[model samples]
Target: MAHSRLQNINNLTTIDAKGAGIYIHIPFCKQACHYCDFHFSTSLKKKDEMIAAIITEIGMRKNELEGQVIQTIYFGGGTPSVLSNQEIQHIITAVYNNFTVIDNPEITLEANPDDLSNKRIAALSNTPINRLSIGIQSFFEEDLKLMNRAHNAKEAEDCIAAAVKHFDNISIDLIYGIPNMSNQRWLQNVAKALQFGVPHISSYALTVEPKTALYTFVKKGIITAPSDEAAQEQFLLLVDELEANGFIHYELSNFGKQGYFSQNNTAYWLGKKYLGIGPSAHSYNGTTRSWNVANNMLYLKSIQEGKLPSEQETLTLSDRYNEYIMTGLRTIWGVAVARVQQDFGQLYYDYLIAQLQPFLDNGLLSFKDGIITTTRKGKFLSDGIASDLFFLR
Candidate 1:
């Protein structure tokens, strides 16, 4: 039985999806949020040039994943909605021209609530983009102000309603753990999202990253740091409410109705090959991971010179196993014990089992058959727990 399970896991190594996915990063935002530390520029002075450069980069890296179909295309970063409908279409056209894409690829755009006006939603529906991921951090005015979000309470509600009319495959982002956020407020936020009939929700607990305005505020006593207790309580509430409403906790931070999972993210977590285009974007092809230069000017100049402004590192065996463990523990898939043994060798499998004993003993992890997964108590702490299990080189 053990031999067969290990064999099946070993076979997963060669099982590639029909095609690779593409990620296009648009790293421009109109307003800088207080808590965000992602690489983005607030100025749109070079927007047009950036767009052209991204398209050019697409062509330059066309052969990176040759012989594979482009299954998913994701527009992420500062604010994908900042681009005009025509600008977006131009890039999509470039993609079609440069790559072999399927008839109906899953194309998603991460839009802000303020950008999803009725007209804009209608125009987007006409495009090939089949999914929308709205950044609706909160539906309350106080929380929005605290986060320095550009959109207000009404826009949050109105946009989702407007988006639902045109797009069925919609996902909205919500943030929890804001200082002074009561449990009741959190419940209301979740309820409002449910009222929208959105098929998917990607919610996260707000954290204070260094050098961000939020961190400075906390240091100056302007804002209270996020409470772990509150975050855990809110996360539990989210799981209970969403699961009751027929949403699967597909990934740690993602919930989707049946057949509504984000194909782009799923492909990423499954270790499928993907190409990322734009400043600060990252790409992976099963072994090597690469990231573009985070500076806008440098990226454009590099692309114009017909060179990629990116750095890549090939994965070692330990790196692959650790990545698999980290991502696997955060999703419903869990870590496949047999796969660890087959791919990383018996030493790794034995090491993993030994490392897992404490978590299993503490009821934070569970092992059944040949799989090891986080228990309900361990869900919120999955990342930390996975780290403790990492195999250091």
Candidate 2:
């Protein structure tokens, strides 16, 4: 792992300017949520073996990283919380043994409500895990039931209190703009999180992914399909409320109090390289991107046979520039025109300025210094703007 950001006050594109973040994916969930499509299994038959394999994978790939320092380690999941304290420690310890961890590297574990009981929370608090990303989704029982989430409303509300007693760097995830979720109810969810003093929150709209239970339910009329208008309204409401409360909307779906932005995810938005381990995990190193097999069983089997079950592609310069525009345009950081010119050359710079004229005239984009950023209205339609600005060459 190198530094996750360019902090040397010198060159920005130097390889060492950004250190790598390590993401360890755990493909086991206690139960499936109606809307989730991430790879995982309810079965724990091979859970122990899976842990060993994960640790082994880290050790084996240590050389691939060429002894780089790891600045952040994130255990994202089907539900990393499903792994016991000992299991979690094993994975962390293995990484420590194989790679050089940066001083005070950000170590995060994505957990759920049901797993945060006093005992379990205490066990986790005892480890090097300092941050928790809880899946609260909604604070209403009816909403929880509709999503078939593993935990109920009570669990969702209480888990944060328990977690806060142990860790201050807590981030709660919420879903707004679900089908028929009223503005008032969304307000209640936000208020509940703020009342608990959660340092960070990641809230998102409920979009229907293909082959998900939520998608099928909507198609069959068992559940109403998500509404774009309501989602947009709710998103606006969330942004206004959180910002009023002194939270910064650092990225599109994320809000952090003061300096608590998600370090691992920030590395991602800045186009830093990272190694993603486990089923369905993704890796990008500025030049290339790769992903693992989505099947847990197959993933385990492939790695066991001394082969990583993943596909890789080296990124073209255009691919990297387009990706930078796509991601950087979504955050408060926006796009630096000088940096763009330096990396992509004057031709790309001319192309970007040409594209910016309409958006600027429409009040959706602004120019200051040598950077171009979206206005508030631009954020709501960021995807379309990014599509228009993408360099196909």
Candidate 3:
């Protein structure tokens, strides 16, 4: 019975009927992590203005997702936990006023360890926000210092202990492939997270993005570049450990227990429409994709003038096909051969099969029931394999 239930969670493909999602980007952080490249500011001076602009953007785009019910409301960041409870409530109220929401939408707040004190978690528990995605990247002092995370190792454990008391739906972020993280250390990290009993875990291989401090450190040989081979080994270890503990490897970078999959991200992988409100947030319908300007000042000025500070592009058939291949292969919902034929016609379907043949023959991908999914051996390489299957014109 337990096995069957887990299987059902792993096979989930569709989202709620007529459902969409909303993502609100809070662009302020207390400090910068060495490896982060996402748009964010370290200043809090403009936070009030930023919040007001975001609420206004939500109102202005109210009709954009007409007739669809919002299934998820995600507060992503520069660290959304920095907002006061009242501020968070105000933003959520704006969402309710502007859009039609489901009876109990999965509202998530991306938070940092330093900000989630016992008092703060209690306050957040009273709000409509029902889920927490905490940034507890590593529970080691060295790793925390290396990454320049604002919180210490003690704070990492402290926050989780406090959080589970108030929120049952919690997910924590972990990084596995830091330059000096050994396989044993990585295993220890996984062990520590399991001890916390978090139902969902999102782990990623740390890559130094261009222009980040990590990049500069690597360029100057102050820190060794992360090894791809090491990352692959650690990833496989994570899959084995997490799955042994009843966690489903639902996506390439995410693991969740039954009933704990991230609704917001699952909707995204299934190609559902969602509106993004704030600086550097992105929005997508089935046909086009748009993103707000990354500059906070520009976003504030435009929103103040009652204009959307964003740009959009329509997706061509080839673009759509490529995206499905990319997102589909990364999750349990493999790319459907029938979906390709029905949506893009015979030519695309044929081209996809031809491109996929080599990986299939090499045991990196498996095709059964007309669905093409990455095999366990191919999981780490899914992105590269997906690129090989792109329907380039």
Candidate 4:
């Protein structure tokens, strides 16, 4: 049955007009990484219950995206790969039963290296999941130990070797800017990922989010905080190396070969509607945004009682315009002047143009053909620039 799904894998690489996506957050993991703060439990005791709640949430909110087609179904969070093939299939079947999914939707599974053993990867190849986003944070053992990742350095390399034989639409993640990592080591990390011949790579700086184990380490001086200067240098190095090797720096932290950009994430960046199921998952329509509660037990209890455990807010005009600016400037697609004028008003258009002038003059932003985009020199600072351009309420 899954072999038939492989026939259309090539067709699932690109994004289309099918605007809706479904993001299922699997909140169970084998263990928590030290540098992480996303919601997930270290125990698998409630795994079955959580899966039931996720499927129920899918049916209960079917009407939220009533007429839209689901172009992508993404399994993200603690470690989606921790679920068995049967469990994963059950949730997917539920989505198909409730939603109008595209004929060849891009179904992505976020797997950690340790969870993707040779047998596991082969079994997954037979499922509807066509894309694998492996979390190979670092190629060095020391870095892996520092981050407290479940997989060691060897498991990281071996998983990619095994995965490539079963999956072609693959993406591996790498983190740079660890406290003591040199630029040379970061380059080697990028080179190791390239050796696998995967189509997509999502690299991010190791940020010290408050309340994570890494934060505590930094606070107690057991580990030094990652330096901003070092991070920026590594970020620029990544951009040059990947772009030179034929990957487009399509988004701030994502690079992909042509026709291989992340369909699920691109949909979000383009302002498409998506339903986020499971604990701590966020959903967005054009006018409003909502998210499920982060507590796994509470989520299951609420769903069992036939109620939605989520909160939502309607977006104001300023909220919409500011979001467009933030997401637009992060991608190759620049913010359109006409869109601001048409979507907001002449007042917004004038304000945006006036605000962007400083960045335009300083070689940080470029304005061409009425679209505003960050220059090569400005890509690393895009977030800060986007904030300055925001229409403060």
Candidate 5:
């Protein structure tokens, strides 16, 4: 079954997502890499305490869901690879005991290439986690050093070999457009990842975000800012290479090898209701959205005092419509005009139709099966166009 045709007014205050997905945040890492801005501390100082609290929070927040079948369970992290097999299993068991997980739910765990030693891979094989997303940002030694990623070229290649022996649903991440990278090396990186025969690959163009170590270094003239022209050229080339190698360009930065899409993430892009647990985790229950504190200490203290440790807002009609436009436009499924009308009323329906006519006339978009999606050219400017067609009222 698919998610909802409707986007508003689900049974809120009903514990559990009606067709919810469960996301457990494993927020501890061995080191902080440059160009990384996610909320994780290098100190595993409170690792044990945090792990215990996450499980506790699951039980405490269990009633927030509706006892529906959980379609996916994803262990996203500071680096879930840092977690022990015992810790992983303990969390999985906690989820099973507290919630009604569906039969054959897709459980994915994200890892780092350096952590994928033979012993660890073999240990992970024994767990229920059927999928592994290894962060192989680049296969070039210089790029790895520049980004301060925890893996070398050898580890990048070897980790996949280790993982493939034990898991079929494997996805590897690659970051392209490094200032020091050449086209030849980028091509090699793509070829090497494909050589492992992994089912999915998520390739991203590197962007220097604010307050990151890379940002600081660039500001101090220690390193150059990202080259936009090079980034664009590399992205185009990467797409061509992957598509030629039989990968589907499922999303802007994601390509799936056949039927191996990341079900958990795909659900999020499609706006499925998923509950996030842990510090900095966000939860959606249809109309209102909530997120826990990003600070580990703040989250732990609040939950200890019997508070949800979260902030929430009820989504307005326009907010929901704009959200639908953004998420739905980025997918292969496209935006279904009829479904929008059914959920958001005819004024929204008519407004979108009228707004899109210019793009439709310009051949930047196409219409069929009562849905509208950007053509390949328009997809490059998808964000701007999607916003243009949104209902602002």
Candidate 6:
């Protein structure tokens, strides 16, 4: 059955990802990473309540999608693997009962190396979750310790070996640009990931976000932050190595073998509608964007009282255009010229074209086939270049 599904993977995965996707955020983790700022609690005291609240939110927001077929169901968070298989399935069952899910939806669960025990992997294989996105930030003791991850180097390599036995559609995340990490170490990390034969790899440069432990340490001169030069060199090396290994650089921080690009993220990048349930999850339905409150206890109380604690913002024309530039520049699909003209207006399109000349001359961006895409030299600088092209309204 697994082999057959792998063969027919594209049908199950999001093709063009036009349909809406579902995002369920799990906000409990065994431990906190030093450089992280995502909303999550180390304590699992309210995990049961949190799951119930997520299910309630799904039921309440079912109508928000207006019967759009759900193509993808993503379990992302502080380590979705912290929940039992039954807990994961309960949320999925609620989705089916309240929402319109198409046949063979692409369901993904984000897990950490420490949580993916052999027994856990086998148990998860029995659930409806078809894909695993492992957070193997690094397969080195020094790096893992630097980030304060729960799993050590051996567990990182071991979990992938175990997970691939049950899942062919697997993606593992690797982080580069950690303080004191050499290019040699970065190359070895990527090489170790490739040795596992995983189909997808997501890599990111470590940054010190404010309020994170790393930030405080850096502010106090207890730790040095990753350098921009080091990050750029490592990122380029990552792209070169992964692409040479037959992986497609589908997005700025994502690479996948053919037919393995992340459907949930693809839907998001293409501006398709999605409903994000659970605390701190964000939702978009064409015109307006909304996000749930980041407070777990408050979210639980509000949902139990039949109210959703979320904030909504209606998108303006300028808001939509700027978003397009940012997401498009980071993706393999460049900003479509005709889309800018038809969706925004000639004025917006002209501004985009006007901004293109400078990047074009400097070989940072290229315009071809009525589309604008970043050049190799500009890939690392994609975010900065996209900001420069933004219509600051």
lDDT of 4 by residue, 14-131 (tens): 4455569999999988887999999999999999888888889999999999778888999999899999999999999999999888787789999999999899999899999999
Writing each residue's lDDT as its tens digit, candidate 2 over 208-282 gives 999899999999999988888898888889999999999989888999886678888887888777898888889
lDDT of 4 at 127: 90
Q: How far off is model 5, as Cα RMSD?
A: 5.2
Better of 2 and 4 by TM-score: 4
Residue-by-residue lDDT tens digits, candidate 5, 208-327:
989899999989999988887787777778878888988877776788865677778777777778899998899987799998899999988887788878899999989989988887
Task: List ranges where model 3 is wrong by over 4 Å.
Answer: 1-14
TM-scores vs. true structure, each candidate = 0.95, 0.95, 0.97, 0.96, 0.92, 0.97
- RMSD per model, one decimal: 5.7, 3.6, 3.0, 2.4, 5.2, 1.8
Q: Candidate 3 — which pairs collide? A: none
User: How many backbone collisions does model 4 have?
Assistant: 0
lDDT of 6: 0.90
User: Candidate 6 regions off by >4 Å?
Assistant: 1-18
The model with the greater TM-score, 1 or 4, is 4
- Tens-place lDDT digits, model 6, residues 13-45: 435445799999999899999999999999999
Error of 1 at 222 (Å): 0.4
Clashing residue pairs, candidate 5? 15-64, 15-65, 15-66, 16-64, 16-65, 16-66
Q: Model 2 reaches what TM-score against the true structure?
A: 0.95
